[model samples]
Target: MSEPKSLEGVFHLVHMIKRHMHEQIEQLDLNISPMHMRVLKIINKQQTCTAVDIAQLLNRDKAQVTRLLNELIKQTLIEKVPNPEDKRSQRLLVTSEGMEVLAHLTTIDGNMNNKMMKGISREELKEFERITGLMTENLARAD
Candidate 1:
C-alpha cells in the first residue's frame, strides 16, 4: 500500500494527539473541557489578555470565547481585572488554582510529547521542527 500524503499524516497525528489528550483530561474529572483548558492556558501565558484577544487567537467567535471565559471564571480558574488602557475591556488572569491546573496540563503535554518522540533523535526532532516552521510560514503567506 502507498504511504499517506504529508498533510494526511499530519492531520491524523493531530487527531490522535487531541484524542489522547482528551482522554487524559477526562481521567482528571476536573469538569473542564479541552477548550476551557486552552483558554486558561492562553490567559496564563498572556500578560494582558482580553476575551477578544482569545477569540482572535483561537479563531473562534467572541461569544464562544466569552462562554469559555465565563466557565473558567465559574470554576475559579481565572479572574478578570480592569484593563488599565481600556476601561471598557478587562484583562484575563489565571488564578493560583488555575496555575496548578495549568501545570498539570503541561505535564500531560510533556508526557505525551516524550512518548511521541521516544525513538526520534534530537537532530531529527530539530529538523522536524524546522520543516514544520517552514510549512507554517508557507501557510501564513497564503493568508
Candidate 2:
C-alpha cells in the first residue's frame, strides 16, 4: 500500500475497533461510555487517583474529567474518599462494583484481542506492536 493508503487503513482500523467496543459495552447495559470505562480502568490502576490525575493522564480538560468522575460516582462504580496526606483533595477509588465491571471489560478485551490476532503469528504481532509504538512516538514528537 502507498503511504497515504496505509495511514487511511490505520485510521479505519482504529474506528472499527472503537465502534466494536462501543457495541459490546452497550450490550452490557451499564450505561457507561467508553471514556467512562477508561476512567474506571485508570482509577483502578492508579494508587491515588483524582480528577486532576485523570485529566492529565487522559490529556482531556478538567471539566470533561469532572463530568466523567461525577457519572462514575453516580453509578456507584467509584467513590471519593478523603486524602490522608492532603486535606484539600480527595482520592478516587474503584468500588467493588467497578471491579466487577472491570473484570467483564477485561474479558471483552481478551476476546477482541484473540479475534484480531486470529490469523497473525506471534512474530508478526510483535512487529506490529513495535511499528505502532514507533508511530505513536512519531505523533508525540509532532506536538
Candidate 3:
C-alpha cells in the first residue's frame, strides 16, 4: 500500500476501535459519547477539573468542552460548582449517577479486554501496549 493509504488504515483502525468502545459503553445506558466519557474519566480522576482542564486533557476546544460540560450537568451525570480560586470558572465532578455509569462501563471494559485477549499471551499484550504507546508518542510529536 502507499504511505498515505497506510496512514489512512491506521486512522480508520483508531476510528473503528473508538466506535466499538462507545457502542459497548452505551449498552450500560450512560447516554454519553466517547468524548463525554473521556471528559468524565479525567474529571473523576482529578476530583475537580475545569472545562479548560478537560479540553487540554482531551485535546479539544475550550468552547466545545464547555458545551459538553453543560450537557453533562443537564443530564445530572456531573455537577458544576464555582472554582474557589476563579469565580468566573466552574469546577466539574462526576455525580453519584456518573459513578454508577462508570462502574458499569468498567465492567464492560474488563469483559471486552478478556474477549480481545482470548488467545494472546500476557507478554504479547504488553508488547502491543508498549508499541501502541510509542506510536502514539511519535505521532503526537509530529504534530
RMSD of each: 2.2, 1.3, 2.4
RMSD of 1: 2.2
TM-score of decoy 1: 0.88
Q: Candidates ranked by TM-score, best first? A: 2, 1, 3
Q: In candidate 1, how many Å is residue 98 off?
A: 1.3
- Which residue pairs in model 2 clash with each other? none
Which scores greater on TM-score, model 2 or model 3? 2
On residues 55-116, what C-alpha lDDT tens digit does candidate 1 reach at each position? Answer: 99998998888889998999999999999989999999999989889988998889899989
lDDT, candidates in the order shown: 0.89, 0.91, 0.83
Please provide, for model 3 over 1-143, each residue's C-alpha lDDT reduced to its tens digit, 9 standing for 90 to 100: 68698689779967877887887877766688877777778888996688888888889897898899988888898998889989999888799988887888778668877776889998998998897798789889995
Write the number of the candidate with greater lDDT, choosing between 1 and 3: 1
Candidate 2's error at 103, in angstroms?
Answer: 1.5
The alpha-carbon deviation from the true structure for residue 138 of candidate 1, after best TM-score superposition, in angstroms, is 2.0
Better of 1 and 3 by TM-score: 1
lDDT of model 1 at position 132: 88
How many clashing residue pairs appear in each of the predictions shown? 0, 0, 0
State which candidate has the highest TM-score: 2
Q: Give lDDT for model 1.
A: 0.89
